[model samples]
Target chain A: MPSSKKAKSVRAATLSDVGREAGVSAMAASAVLNGARTSSRISPETRERIEEAALRLQYRPNAAARALANRRMDTIGVATVFESRELNPYFLEVFNGILETAALHEQNTTVFDWQRGAAKLPGWCDGRIDGLILIAPTLTSEAAKVLPGHTPFVAIHANVELPNVVNIETDEERGAYEVVRFLISQGHKRILHVSGVAGLVGSDRRLRGYKRALASAHIGLDNALIIPAGFCSDDGYRAMRSWLQQHAGELLPHAVFCVSDGVATGCLEALSEVGLRVPDDISVAGFDDTLSARTTLPQLTTVRQPLRAMGNRAVEVLLDRIHRQNTGDKQLTEKSIVFPVALVTRASVGAPPAIKRVVPSRR
Target chain B: MPSSKKAKSVRAATLSDVGREAGVSAMAASAVLNGARTSSRISPETRERIEEAALRLQYRPNAAARALANRRMDTIGVATVFESRELNPYFLEVFNGILETAALHEQNTTVFDWQRGAAKLPGWCDGRIDGLILIAPTLTSEAAKVLPGHTPFVAIHANVELPNVVNIETDEERGAYEVVRFLISQGHKRILHVSGVAGLVGSDRRLRGYKRALASAHIGLDNALIIPAGFCSDDGYRAMRSWLQQHAGELLPHAVFCVSDGVATGCLEALSEVGLRVPDDISVAGFDDTLSARTTLPQLTTVRQPLRAMGNRAVEVLLDRIHRQNTGDKQLTEKSIVFPVALVTRASVGAPPAIKRVVPSRR
Candidate 1:
């Protein structure tokens, strides 16, 4: 039979061709060449011979051909909403970690916009990716079932638990409590908590943490102080601005804790607009020490979630599941992986002002 | 022969199956079902028959299978450096636009981390993506030659001109001149320009514009006022801080013009650290009206580059080139497309301070 090398057009070297060159069985070449789990049993000398043969043949791994063999595409899909307002500093930090780890493992990362919701997820699973990682997914249990069961999946900050999918999350409620507790320790009274959207777990969890901290400190929860704002800088600005406009002559809170860094950034802008100085007239704190946390003037005092580490672990867990499924050992014992959060004290927070200043009527 | 419906497992319907169901040749089905360029010549009745057959069979286009027919992957690879430091706000705005346009055209967008540079680009072109988009690539002309000639490419803010690739760029020099001229119009004679890296085209062009504006205004350029700094926020902060420390008690410039929004953000922090206030003590301006521009306390007065529009156009042009290349028409008449730049006047800039303030010693 004619060798593939002598074909009319030059073609990529196959496992069979590598085996033919190395004087071994096609299975032996597959183990060493594709890094299959069985490759460990192959002798070091044989592995070296296969590797040398592949190099001499200039063999490049064909993504398509490998999919035919093990049905593994060696690509991971990242699903997130990519709207203008939603693409916050949090996504950038997490994605940086995802791309870093994926590259380290010689895997490709492709992103899918989940704007159309969970219904469109199964369609994206049609052979393009080995697994998918949903970022801060807000899907119901019923909606989560739309994800195909055959593919391994992972979620970071997922609002709901999906069967068989590992969820990587931070101790956000604890983080909020710790930060607020720190604010209380700084002698702050009448603290204002600018909450996120009412229904979201991300929002409510922080709100819960705020109430718990206030109760532990023996301070009554001021229902008026808990302003329900949406996420993003614009939302925070609008919420704070409207509140200030309504109570122009009322005493300002000693400190304000915003739900996210983006919100905190907006609050700072609004405060600055109203001629209030951060940490001097009133201290400010934020959760999720994202880029926005550090970029603002006087830098925000925020809760540090190890977002990059979480992203790296998500890829590692998903890859382990993929490999286990490939080897016919597919049980995932750990359904939840939570990382601890810490307080990042920056220039944003300070001792409460000596005098309670009234909210000025104009800038 | 039995129809495909009798198959044991449900399979995606192919053009041949559609043809059989519609009682027509496979070529007719290819034209109608595949929507090939030739499909326009088919009669309305035949198209309707093919559509009905496809609906009955539940035909869905398989990405891999379609690539086999047209040698087109229907996917575009976006090559950029994804790192904690490199993942600037500039990329987020540009990427949003790319995703939006790609979704509209039904094209899949996959990201390739180009941290390894041009050496890894050819390896990525192995039958996976139809074309590639380079975002803010700093490839040398020699390095650009390594790109595979067969694949189409579109570049946004590419540092060097490639032989056949279409390059999308903004007029940074003009933006710089207009902004500096505006600063002069605001009664600022002594202006400090904190620039990006010295060798980069982006840096040099803006420098040239600054000098041109100074010369046109008959104001002699002060070599001491042009401080060389990198682009990121930290670079800007350190540069400004070091300069202020070295020039303690010296007369401060009436205005500070930063090379990018990130740099301006840092300058704001450094200025705030001292006793200086924006537009009151020293008017500050920035280039590249990115998210950092708006997120600042006093919104930045900078240049608008239309980054999203550039990203959208990059996908469009690359797709056009890919289709033309598939049809054997690969002439690229235009090598570079320059987008106009505009100045955004905001609260950052104001008239020069009434009296020159000395650089304060410390925070």
Candidate 2:
């Protein structure tokens, strides 16, 4: 998209240019134009003249000079793995909060999207950012050990315990428990649980909560009802569709509880394809009341994690740590910060029907 | 959350430390450990030993040093207004593409979120980023004039043309025309248009397209059916709901054409609240095939703007401009790059009902 003609040789206007145009010293011009802390002493008339000159000259404050003087880049780094081409709604919601808070603080946010085995994480700790926030990092203990001590870090849903990083997490087990209990209270005897990856801590916690809730009501755990699925919508769709195909003509579960809103969305689509309607033929619920939950026609009955609030809180805590480190104060030693979750009752869930429905064969 | 205890004084190991541990010169260590371009001649034995020594010392490459050595940060800046706390799906889709391309180029993406009238955009031009991408910037001519000449910039959906900056956009008029024409073909004579802000270029273009499509089909334009709304779902919901309230007992439009998918989703909710079934009662369509379109049941029939492709192209063009600037070559003179749009027919739209239904009053 470049032109063949050469660009003009004129350089951008500098502080000196503004000063010359304003008939003042560069220091006086800088004070008034760049909003330097030392500008309080400048007269109002002089300040007005400097501003006019700056506008006429189109002067821009040099960020490098400011950074060098303040010894701060005023930037925060977000490190995460972009596992797929599609944008993840979970990341979108959390990032919206991060951006909101970072904007309030007038800080820049740099995203570092790393692949699973790149292990290039250590190189990012240099002076580019004041601090780093890790999103659902699956780092091993050994990998975490090599993190640079110079930079402060905050982790959200960290899989392993880092030495000193303060991890922010939600009570997924409790969220799962409440939602499943609510379904059971609606007279749902047979419930299908589309769990996340079998071994992940978050998935396992939700499974425990589901079992605990069922046991409380004296309902035995049906091994056949528990199915393994990954986190995304495609996983939910394939898992549910295949299960329905295999159990064609068999008694269907009264309700299905998904590990994530995305999974629930897929389940809805799969159910629609199989001529079954949500909450009418079979009640369906999901976890994590993300935008997908509300986007659905019969909105999902799910657990609401305070994701945005936690994101805002992470920035505040990270900024505090950055300030402490700059002042040579002791670093944060807290192990983790936990946020509460609530049950969101929406249109997706309903009581079981008087007559049991059997799975119809897929056309 | 900082602890009161004094912190340990140990610093991160550097390349020099790894070199010393490996009994090699710093240059040799740089070649082996940092993957310097000059490292091709290094023997396998030396490379393995250097790697092991680097691992033993836990040495990580310093990004700041590399940036300083190359005199380029290898980072791109994305500036936008985060008007609301919620992440705009438009931003999300475009950003997904930006992130993908940026990752491919091994470049960092730093987001600068500014409030309206903040006007601190110039301060971001200093050395940290190679170039800049402005997302849907609405700069007045005066504001556009103040942009720094030294930094190369590419704008996506820019409202006003900036000097020497390439703007990336889509043919909204055509997209709108095609979708409206499709509705007319489906036997929808009385169609309501929920448009964006009246004066905005995008909104006006869509309006023109709707009129043109109607003219082509020999249908008279109905001023009463052209309602004003903002881009978000709340605006759509409020506008449609209020219209329904006012038009109670009046003949309903055979279909509603919304400006964006968010608005369409809101329209769906509003219609449902009034007990109107989609397609059965009235057909609905939206523009911008964002994720929200698919998330909704009976997914939206909308216009597809290649937002991700546009985002990826912006980065590529920006990178090119950055390179040309570095080489002191010619500057870009192109005013705008326009991408084509297509109609995506999904479940939300269908043939108009045989009978003209009246707007039902709320229960």
Candidate 3:
């Protein structure tokens, strides 16, 4: 029955069809339907007839035609890399904000998977989208040089300084510093830092903050205490498990500061496997209070980077640039928009235990 | 410095520039560059020269131009609803699959926020996208009749049978039945079912499964134990919290079967607040083994719907429809694609506690 009904339906009504029904020229119909500047010249009665005809036909303007006339597609492109075939929770949070703001502006959001480099970026500027947003792009200086100038771009946590591209970021170093200092204040002297991938701007900033916090507390930094773990939970789990295996029977760190909530989740799993109780044996803290933070049993005491707000701002800044380009305005816009980060205290973190705990052999 | 470099960059090379460099006509360059049927007429030497010239100029074809020439945009549209300003993990899992497959096919994925209706769908088929994918669309019969005939559509978890559209779905009722049976086998006699929205198909199927399982065991259904909760975590939390408050002195259910992982998370929070440990005090199970399942301290025991594979299939089916429509091929596609669901046993579910547990007062 549904198929029969669909079979009876015809193609969408065009401007010419509406014009014919209203007994007017297609040009006059276009002017009235699209609210063109010449619409005022049409008679009020004729305008009413055109509107009625359009309503009856359920006429909706074609996006391609509208885009051709205005030279604007009204679509924003988002480019990001997926690690291990999974889109992290951080992307979901930011994309939620982007979707909210984009819907408010009546713009469509298209996503493209940027495998590794920015080399394919130029090919994307072929006029299908008016602007693009690069989410945490790690671009080489050479790849950055070849970026097309016609399409506007906005980068969130860009690894390098892109010429004319506005970068939206959080005060990551300060957030790391505050959380580490909080850990130190709780009498955690031997603190281990499970860090992110080396050479990334975010990773480097968080590492610097960790070192600075220890130095300020007059606590010596132990090279053995720093573990190289990537951002994902699997990476954190493997890193923590290996670290424990290598340091078996040695005194465990008083607290652990993980680079991300995902990493902290892995660390928790590793600790639980070794029959160690969190906060009872050692305190654990994570960065980026993503959804994963609250999902954990004791809930992660992590730093909030305001990722959603940053996503919302990326759209606003990109739109501003698009507007300026369209209007031939050359006024400079803000190059960097930095958001503040906060420390969220949760059950995962507590004062160091009175008795120093040693790493136990894996079961 | 980036701005200075950007200012010095020239506009992208056009087809004419490549032709001029190759010492050939623009038509010849177009044939070779685009690999048109006419390319075979040109000599291999000339084609090689044109290719070299193209590489030298770094020329890329304009998408708009190509689309205009081929009557295809090479873009697919995805429409879905966002609940409480958050894109649930369910969407993320499906979207990841979509992104992966879409990349392999070199198609762009544009997302549109469809705020609860099929009425706005017809307006989206404006020649900008080749096809559209509707994610769990709740459509009225009246609205379904007016779906645009020109655009190809594939729905994942569509509530009703859409005429001429392929609907991809999972065996939810079976999944729910198996999980409940598993709980019953663990000696959980009194089970509480936290259901999704009452009228929705997924909710109804899950509810039916619970009743069928109980009936098979000759256990009478307790309407009082069936809490009317929506799909989200907040809904589960609120429903569980209120149910416990209203029956402070009553014996707790042996196990709770939630509609989703998000709801199970909320249930866990509520139980924890009441000083009841999961599996130890009362077992909890959920449907939809989303990312939230593993994030919990004791991961959830739930049903796996293969949402990612469903998403990938939606794209494939939609693309097939688009190709068929474009080539004037009238072969009918499968109206419904039902995928099998499986039970994923984790740490959440366990045997009933040795003694009957009473609901405690809220702290």
Candidate 4:
């Protein structure tokens, strides 16, 4: 072997090679090594020969063929909606967990982009994968109905009701309320909230929590302060930057509650450009303790949604349901597993200065 | 229907239902709608009845049947080593692109957990997925040889050379050398390097570039300044922090060249903890302009690896190779494609401070 090719081209041996070495039929070798059901009645001597031959040949069963015979692909499909946006870190965390657990069960994990639409999903949800995992799906009720009935499905943070699907959701309402309450405890009043898209279940839940927190504290809801910002960090930056430009000379709120860590990261950028020090001039708290939170200058004070844990748990539940759905004749179980959220205190939130009754506007 | 029952009972009508409702055999219905290759030779009247019956019965061919008959799972596998470390934003970028393109091709992508020995890979390659995409694989040479030859593999940043595999790698050497040269132009003679794992191709290539840049600038290499670090952000933080503590009061290098953006973020955190401002105190440059680069307060001056494009291209190349591999008796092609890296100038770099003379030790 040449030096350049020395370490690179190592091809694995196949079953036919084992069969030939074993002096048995390919089916006999397949039965012993690759688990072909039809070849189960092979002689003991032949089986031993096949096994020994497989060892000598270093035969590895082909993945595609195993799937063909078993009807169990041993692969989980993750259906998500991350596209042009660079906010994939959030999805990546959840996906990492899914991969971790899926691998443990000897399953391969696949991701499906639901950002396109439910129109194209029926084809994807077929015999190819054993089960499908939906992440933050915003499927229309009509389109959701088109999902294949034979396959099992698990959804994370689904916006609408998906029939026969086990929805894994975080308590976003409580998470929002907790962060807002923490901000209030720090002597902050008149807080500004940059929210996610309206009509989105997550956005509504967080907004409701914000309102509930305000009511509990006997603080009046400031309609002008609640703005619908999108999910991306860029959205947070633009939303905050625009607000600052419009409210240039106005009294700033003591704290700004961002909907997600991506938003918080963006808001920090906007603040930096305008020279507003986090927690010093104005406090910032974000929902969802994603990777973005810790990367920021003053690491964000945010609510921790167990995204990875949820992803891992979703795989376990989905796998269980898939086996039951396939082997146990369409057995349906109770739907929805809701996980609690935690408030993660970090450098972004602190006590409001005594002299500054109102926070300074970045503009 | 009550919500509980609604959630539990979503049985999909199958092709058998369509056959029964259309007053024909299941094979006849399959011949009409499932698009099986028994020939597109169904009677026009029977086809119309099958279509009508399918609509009335809401019948869809079982995905498993389609997969078994076609041997086209429409699923691809994505293997990565993300589970071992904290979620890095770098993987997110490439994964997003993979998801987007896979969706466009109507291909479902499965993620394979890469922590298992390469022995585990052959099990996955057996038949579950049509093809495999290896994301940043660090496979041992022995294990690499065990990868199944039947399944086509496309590797992104393959640490070791793989035979019969098309490895997609960024030109980190050029990027590293250019970045260091840029730093050298800023009057920084003693630039410290926080390297990745000692044996990784990326680590050695970056070290070579750093040395090449120093040589080009006529600066003597200081072995003490080059610290051993690894890929993760935490490694960078720990490496730089330990260096800072050990060299307390000594004059800092004009610039610190970090392994990747994740490492750079950790470096920033370590510097911040010590009350040292970036660029003003010492400049830092990162490789692999991942999302963390932009997320950081002082956006990283780094090298962009075109991860998203590489991911998209991987899909194209993998699909192409899969097609060629499946085209009759020809073997899979053994061609390799290398992508170039570009310098990304953000806010992290600045001119070296004039006051280089100092000796202050921490007491």
Candidate 5:
């Protein structure tokens, strides 16, 4: 076999090929074809000849060569951690927004898998991408300190504050507070809270909101009613199931407020397994009105975070930062951009049952 | 303000900087640092000096310069079409597998939004990616003929055959036949098929499987029972709702076999709206056991297509082709790779209701 990859087909036309066809040097051809600043010095007749040759040869500029000349790859990097070995619905919604805005700006989006606490982040600062958007990164202060200073970064729901990084966040505390208030308005005195991973900023904010809502309604906080669960469906399921088993025959809460939609799905399953119905035997509410919220049997009455809009804003903010960096502007304008959250009332939330329900014993 | 972007921080060390620090030419440093063939020409003392300077400066090679030197980008392109302005669960499962395999191979993955019938595909062959993976492309023959021959291509569930493209597919016909057979075994006589878009290979194969299963069971085909629906949830919801409205006061089918899990979720929602309980009022089955299958209220009894495994296989096959292409071997091997499918029994499918159910009139 010949040592040529394009032996069987025609190869793409390059600047040299176009230059030869136009009877000019490769530098002159590149100047005219790429619309470089030096092209203005070329005569109109010579420029027209170069342009005609390029069109005839179907010449397309190589991305690598163009990037070398302009120092812009026109690509944005998205670094995210997949939960439970899969990209959850929350990430999907946000990514859709990011992809949409990035495409509109004619920038290619490349994805990088981010392992928490991994120091491989600095390795991604090579010149392949112009900027990066971090999705819900939970970096320690030490890891945050080592972030490459040359590259501009924008984060969505960053767990810790990083120097010179803009964090896009939602008003989760208010969302949790409003949802709990809505449950209270439905005449639910005792509400169980399924909190997210302990000590995280998001989890702590939601916990504060839950306590504040109960106190405002004159319903004392029952520490026993607070169940610690992670952000996944399995966590919610295991927590609910084990709680029921340990407190068998104990009085059940009037409503269960899950930290996320995924966790709420698991809570629903655990409840159904013991022959209990949602919003009937006990009301259930979930944060983050993801697609699963509507797919449930009775549909979930949950708090809606504008995840898609926040994703779009992350790209916009990152682009602004990149532009400022390119223009040598080191001023930090906004540290955080917060979006509002709303409560969506659906079939999952109804008036408490006429009869008080007790936790069913494990079959 | 200064015009220099890196005035506030130390700039990343370049090959020239390393060479200057090591008292060697830039070309000598490049060969030693990039491990090029010419590195053996340098003496041991010079190589050691270059290595020490590189370590001291914390040098990282630029991706663009590496690609230019090797004529390989070490990046794979994933082109996919988003349905209903969002990526469905099916794409998510496959993408996760691709990302896992690609990362393991030290390749970056860039995503491009492909619009159906658009001629923008040929433009992507500008040497930015070593190979391209098309996810369920529905291209016309004319469009297929125009695919650039210089680049290697791998497609998953491509609608039409493209010359020199390796297609990764699943046994959809078998999957569909077994699910319908399972429904029949549960005592379902009148089964409704919610087919995907008309004329697509996947939808047609599934339709064939549904027909063959009915024929083997000696059941006559009912044209009215087969409702045409797209792959998205909204399509399935509208199709089911309209079918129910048109058949008001008529006997309902014993079960519904939707083309995809997303469609199944929609079917469940439409049934719930009209006060029909899944597996109790009527049975429902979905295909492509995606994440949504388990998240639904009763869960979903669907066909598992091993989407993740197929995605992993796609990357492997594409990498092999890329290697062969680089080595100047144009020989074609393995035109198609088929993966097996299985039926997953969940909470959705059950025996038909005891009483004859009739479609209720719309309120």
Candidate 6:
């Protein structure tokens, strides 16, 4: 792929070369070209000439040279176990935002699909990317021990906290609490909780939030009402359908709070099959306002995670860390940034009916 | 990214070395190790020993080396335009299938977002991948001229057929014919065709099939019922909603044939907004059995393009072409592959009700 015959000698443009051509010192040129030194300034005429010259030469700041000089690749790696699993619209939004932000900062982004187990991950420490972002990594502690300390990492929804990794996660508890509270405010006491995998951090956070809201509202936390579902729509559908069939004549919950949008979609399907209408018979709410939520007939009233914003933020942070790491300062300050979650009001959720709502089955 | 000095000598392992270590000829090794010439067999005992030796050495025949020797990278580049405009489930299915087949062949796959346009493309073709597979590339002939000729190219759902490029597509005409026939069988003579982009091949093919099917049934094609729409849900919604507004008091079509599931989803929304229930007031059918088709409350009865299968097939074929090109057999006899479509029966399409469907507007 290296097209040039003198591949080894082919070098990225340097400030020194620009200065030499512009009859100026390297530091002065660097200041004018990159606007790096806040104290330094160049006149408008000189600045225009330098910019024009750089453009004419197709001057690209060599990434490798900068890394060598500053110890910063200004690149972040996103490692994830996301190949076979459905990467719903949530991931897409966040990733899109990340790409946009990274591009804005003149930083490169590298994505790694860790279809392999975490055991093969330590090799990622070959001084390639300055920092790493693990997206929903479901790795065992033993496997996670392979992570190299040389590079800093920020994780989004890490299943298990790695000792050194800064976890950038949402306040699922507060979001869940507010959503459930909103449902109860409409006088729905028998609220069903379609929970995600029990032990995962995100899943647990949501569950805790749902329970806290119930307790705060003086509502009993019905253990039997919490159905073990998953992040996928099919999982939600199966769990709800099974519950519906098992509890044929029983009173349905006034509202259902699904762990994720995928699950919510499934829950809606199950309700439809049983001839139940959303909001009319049993109100339903979901988390993660993914594209699926909008695509649904009765658009889901769900928790907005601001995934794209987070994605863009993650890139900025990762690049900044990379830049700093290259500057010979690996300050391991334990930093955690939390973004606010908003509840999107859609057609799916409404006031609870006067009675325990019931309807006939589709088949 | 190249960490060590070993990159200079980091040539991929070859079949010859494996054969030498196993005390066999290179051809024999290729036969036994790669399992090419599958019908031919090596001795069971020798085969076992060869396999053991191959495992012991942790041998992965270097892609670049194999590519150089046989003139193939064992890699395919999938170029896609599904960035901001069309993030449909149809693309996901095909991508999954491509991944599945690429893994099976031990070939590497790289996805290029053609949304970036042709400017960034030539840089990607510097011998990294042997062949290119373009998915629904809406490139003008001027843009197509920029494609690198060194590597062979294949296309799926291409906007315009490129000279010397093999195009893989589905029999949209027949699929359209079958779906419309199904609607006709249900006594839907006044069928409305909500079509895709006006001049695109997919649109033309579907329209042809619709007209041909109606003609076959001795039914006349109603130009008034042929509505112009595009790919996205918004386009479908706007088209349908506008149609409703225009024909507020007119008798509605017996059934609506949408070009894609996304459009159908929008159609469902428009219908729901007017309080006209599907099948009860009118029936609806869609093309491309994407995930959205299943996610809808009443699962859509649509034409399945086997997008995933096509994705997988594209990878395999591209790899083969790559190998053939490398080996100096530059001839590609066939220029196209068309997969047969399937009729997925679901809840969306049903017998038309007796009542003439009409959407009542507030105005």
RMSD of 6: 8.4
Cα lDDT, all candidates: 0.85, 0.84, 0.85, 0.81, 0.87, 0.75
Candidate 5, residue A295: CA error in Å? 1.6
Task: Show where candidate 6 strays beyond 4 Å.
Answer: A1-79, A83-87, A98-113, A119-132, A148-154, A321-328, A357-363, B1-76, B104-109, B126-131
TM-score of each: 0.88, 0.86, 0.91, 0.86, 0.94, 0.78
Q: Candidate 6 residues B1-363, lDDT tens each? A: 645433342222356777777887766677777656661678887777677767665555433334444434455667666565645566666766776777677555555655676776665564445577888877778888878666689899877878778888999999999999998987888888899988899989998989999999999877989999997888788888888888987888888899888898899888888887776687888899877777776778889998878988888778777766645566787888899998887887777777574657654
Model 4 TM-score, all chains together: 0.86
For model 6, what is the error of residue A110's alpha carbon versus the real structure, in angstroms, after optimal superposition? Answer: 6.1
Chain A vs. true chain A, TM-score per model, equals 0.88, 0.88, 0.93, 0.88, 0.91, 0.83
Two-chain complex of model 3, DockQ on C-alpha atoms against the true structure: 0.41
Q: Report the number of the highest-lDDT candidate.
A: 5
Clashes of each: 0, 0, 1, 20, 0, 3
After superposition on all C-alphas, the RMSD of every candidate to the true structure, in Å, is: 5.7, 4.9, 4.0, 5.6, 2.5, 8.4
Tens-place lDDT digits, model 4, residues B1-363 = 444433444556677888899999888888888665863788888889989999887675655556646656666778777756777566777877787788778677777766765756776664557789999888888878887776788999888998888998887888899999999987787799999999988898999999999999899999998999888889988998888888876878888999888888899988878877788878999999877888898999999988888889999888887776655333545556789989899888988887652233232
Q: What is the alpha-carbon lDDT for the whole of candidate 4?
A: 0.81
- Model 2, residue B104: what's the lDDT? 85
* Clash pairs (backbone) in predicted model 1: none
For model 6 chain B, where is the 10-residue window of minimal lDDT?
Answer: B4-13
- In angstroms, give how far residue B76 of model 5 lies from its true place: 1.0
lDDT of 5 by residue, B1-363 (tens): 646546554557899999999999888999899875778988999999999999998888888877876778889999888546445777787888899899989898988878655477877778888899999999888889998888899999998888899999999999999999999999998999999998999999999999999998999999999999988888888889888888888888999999988888889988888888888989999999888888897999999998888889999999999999877776779888899999999999989987665667455
| Model 5: per-residue Cα lDDT over A9-119, one tens digit each | 466799999999999998899889887477798899999999999999989888877776667787899998865644588788888888888988878788987865547
Model 6 / residue A23 / CA error / Å: 22
lDDT for each residue of candidate 6 in A1-363, tens digit (9 for 90 to 100): 644433242233467777777767766666676557642578777776677666654454433444435544455666766544564566566656665776577554555557877754554444445678887788888877878666678777677768767667788899999999889888889999999998887889899989999999999889999999889998999999988877767787899999999899999999987778888888899999887887787889999997877887777677666555545455756566678899888999988877763444444
After TM-score superposition, the amount by which residue B272's alpha carbon in candidate 2 deviates from its true location, in angstroms, is 2.1
The number of the candidate with the highest TM-score is 5
